[model samples]
Target: MPSYTYPVAAPNRTLTTEEIHILLTNTRVLARRLADLTQMRFVADYLLSGRFDATGGGIFYETGEEIFAADAPEAVAPGSEYPKTVLTAGELASARTVKWGIETDITDEKIAQQGQVVVDRALARLANTVIRHVDATAWGVIASKVTSTEASAAWTTPGAALEAIVRVQEERAALGTGLDLSTVVLAPAQYAKVLAMLVDADALPRNDSNPVLDGTLPLRAFGLEWVTSPHVTGTDPWLIDRAQLGGMADQTLGSPGYVSASGVGIETLSNRHKDDKYEVRARRVTVPVVTEPMAGVRITGTGL
Candidate 1:
């Protein structure tokens, strides 16, 4: 029988202050890259500073108020008419912290092999988790707004999706709010489907030199800024009047404190096991709210 000898364990090596700084710096760079991947910054207006007060009030315009025309009379009527406005008080319903972290045992072998790469990957993952949470929260708020429907069939044609969006715009117009529908956000599959339709119909002007086709500019279709987000799944796409959608964040901590266009906070904690293990963490706090539900519409049943 052959006897097998156990491999010796590697010794633990303490990281120097300079090495620690480099790890943190690299981690921050990775976090920023992950933050750039988030989609909320393109669709929702964000307020980075202000405490979320549950007692805060919201203003709502009463719908269907009639406008009367005055006849040219010898005597001017002293009566004044004004649209009814209601102050609906409500608190910010969503306020929470999201966090992601990782712990790794520091081994001499790992240090020799540039173990900081592990921390860099962890920080990148954490940043992505935090940013995605913020985006999901924003989408949740937007989804809660008014919803409209299209024909219960898959949009197989290019202009078909545009028609669905136009219906939402028409609804806003019918409300007489004079809000311009400026933004359309859809799932990636839907966007690709619509783009193909446009291409097939020859409706989209094409130029090999065009920045939009070359990916230098954003894709704009039918006078609406087109945005694709994975957060929007299934058959529901959103049409929004930018003026009516607003969001704010408390700045008491800092500009976007926990969450921002840049990235979230990353911290390192020394473990009690004689530096045998250490923890790396990322965290963010944010609350996204829809200020005017009437200004946006969710289109469902696209069958995409």
Candidate 2:
């Protein structure tokens, strides 16, 4: 059997004392929230059967209620005119704010427990928001922040985001007796290329790779599974009813078999559907931080 060293090696980026201190200071909350959002996106799409369309920090529009009374002969019920309205996703860069402050000054065993609490709360909120937004008729299907700790350290690289996903999966695995990595699914961008690299490096199997199941691995942990988002347009396009459309619906068509009822308007429904990609960030709590000490690091020699 190949002997494995303690604290198995993993890739990491070095941070200066000033950076580390900042991470533990007011930035800790932001880091935690970013971690949560990263993981939530993974869970929502992979673990669950729903699709997550990225917004790329772009704004989106959603419809809302504007009351309108129905025409009646003699009876009247309480209702407002224009019963339905639209609600657009506000600009992310402008509307959202990230706040962070060290909840505790100590960094002992309590650190892990406290961090877990913070992570769980943010993750719960993220999951709830994504599901609610997707289910809402006004919002239709869109993606935004799952959770955010702060803006400073939101994920900028694929690797950082991937690691955050692994951390979340490992925690759940440890709690359950018979659980496996497959309970969670992972899909990465540039997955096929990454897989080829892994194969060349002799890290992954080259033949018969399979799509990952949920929790079976970290989201983006495997190079074989990748998910692509469709292209979306408009600054913030809300779903409008066909009737609300007027002269815009009466424009002349140039393509054959794609004309309107009067052969005047172009066919809009035949266009390919697309969605925006949201900017996401991911962070890990364990990289580089030695939360525990090892048994020995010194050698003793007899005097001779």
Candidate 3:
């Protein structure tokens, strides 16, 4: 077997910190690292499935006590016609659909010096920014529409978090919304506590074979899996029935010549001869709304 883990020739000289400092940004590792956030777009789409194809500037929905009321069938005489119920229109609500975009310029000289990877990197960076914004917008809408419920001391206290989660689950069942809240979006602090709680309960083995010891949290509890978002956080975590929570809308078509990306609106690249640079622009027109208020409940004060 090779001694330094890999076969080996010994180093001719020591790799001093002084020499490493010179090439730190470009080598030894990638010069840049993107944000490593938990993937939550699926969660967004699941909770907000109202996607429309039009790039129209406005979106309208109806809401009210009557529209949202759960109605049950009433029995009548076998041969009689069902009693007529007066139809009442719910209040109309409208939201403006907004366009979000980003643009950057790349010069030929920079491309020559740094290669096309530089341009690709710029595109990737800007694209991720747009995606992050989209998620943030959707999460913000959900957070704002949530019904605030009981607080919990789960973060620092063992056995306290599960009770809070159960209580909200019960409260939601009591509402008779006909939909069950299936997921909880937790914060990092609360998640750590849960890992400990699992080990304490003997649900996870306390050994090297345990996933937790290897820096992983593999767990399911109360018939639901927890979710976490860097953007969607506070003292309150959301418990939502993704299928009934809300929706999002965005425009699909672009002007005659612009390029298109899936789920993103329009993108265009053009050579700016006069300026000696290339311009890259992207736009995503989207709107998110919470139509069913009863579909989500906030687990308040858990981070505390």
Candidate 4:
């Protein structure tokens, strides 16, 4: 009692409300950038959900036959009725959760200033992992559903590539499905090769009047919109009707407050405890399906 005074405890300097806002903003921006870097999100339809549903279905019309009428005197029988076909998506056997967490020690002094950096790193990791899953799913759908694979060693030439795409279009037309092959998605290397060949052939239109040249490759030669993706893997290119691709996301999973609670779908969260540690997490439930196998064509063995 006569001797010593207790040392004053240091005041807690945890991140303030403003700093938290900044950290979240930065994390969101980084996450969006990662999404933009990958083509899967852009090419495939994206769905957001609050809940997960295992089964989904879509409907299509069967091709109707044309009846040729004989002379006016001859009676023509009515064409048989065509029934609508139903395609049910396979059950979503599983949901993928991509998440990351960060912890800062209690003694750390730069939590406010460096919080954004920590959050950014975690978000970047989450974004990349999610994109990889999405790309893999899309690739699988294309591989399993494409009507045919056109192998070619002539992809280096614009004419050859054009011919390959045209072949797909012709096949689809022959099926009389009326599914327009409007999008051409190629692996990065193949896209570059095609671009060079097109430039050499002067197939790209000139727009000297515009100060900025369009970096997008022109696909008018094949009557398609060109989309290049690193995710397309291998030497194959996919010609597809975008409408036939199915994508679903659990809306509730990615909601703003999902991190704290656990339910279904995608969610993100962050928190700090009395121990002076920080944490973050992300989760999602999604799947991609191909409603029509004949709506896509895969051109392979391009020798790229």
Give candidate 3's total backbone clashes: 1
Sliding window of 10 residues with minimal summed lDDT for model 4: 1-10
lDDT of 2 at 136: 32
Sorted by lDDT, highest first, which candidate order results?
Answer: 3, 1, 4, 2
RMSD of each: 11.7, 26.6, 10.2, 13.4
lDDT of 3 by residue, 1-304 (tens): 0001111233354434333222222221211211111112234554576665434777788643353324455788889887666666756877777777787876767665665455546656666667678768878888777665666665454456667777777876776657677777766666666666667777654563354655433234557656554567675666777667667776655565355543333344333446766666555677887777777777666654
As a TM-score, model 2 comes out at 0.20
lDDT computed for candidate 2: 0.26
Among these predictions, the greatest lDDT belongs to: 3
Q: Which candidate would rank higher by lDDT, 1 or 3?
A: 3
Deviation in Å, model 4, residue 257 alpha carbon: 1.4
Stretch of 10 with least lDDT, candidate 2: 287-296
What digit string (tens of lDDT, one per residue) describes model 4 on residues 195-229?
Answer: 77777887766763211253433244445566665
**Which 10-residue window in model 1 sums to the lowest lDDT?**
1-10
Model 2 alpha-carbon miss at residue 286, Å: 41
> For residue 155, what is the lDDT in candidate 3?
48
Q: What are the models' TM-scores?
A: 0.60, 0.20, 0.69, 0.61
| Candidate whose TM-score is highest | 3
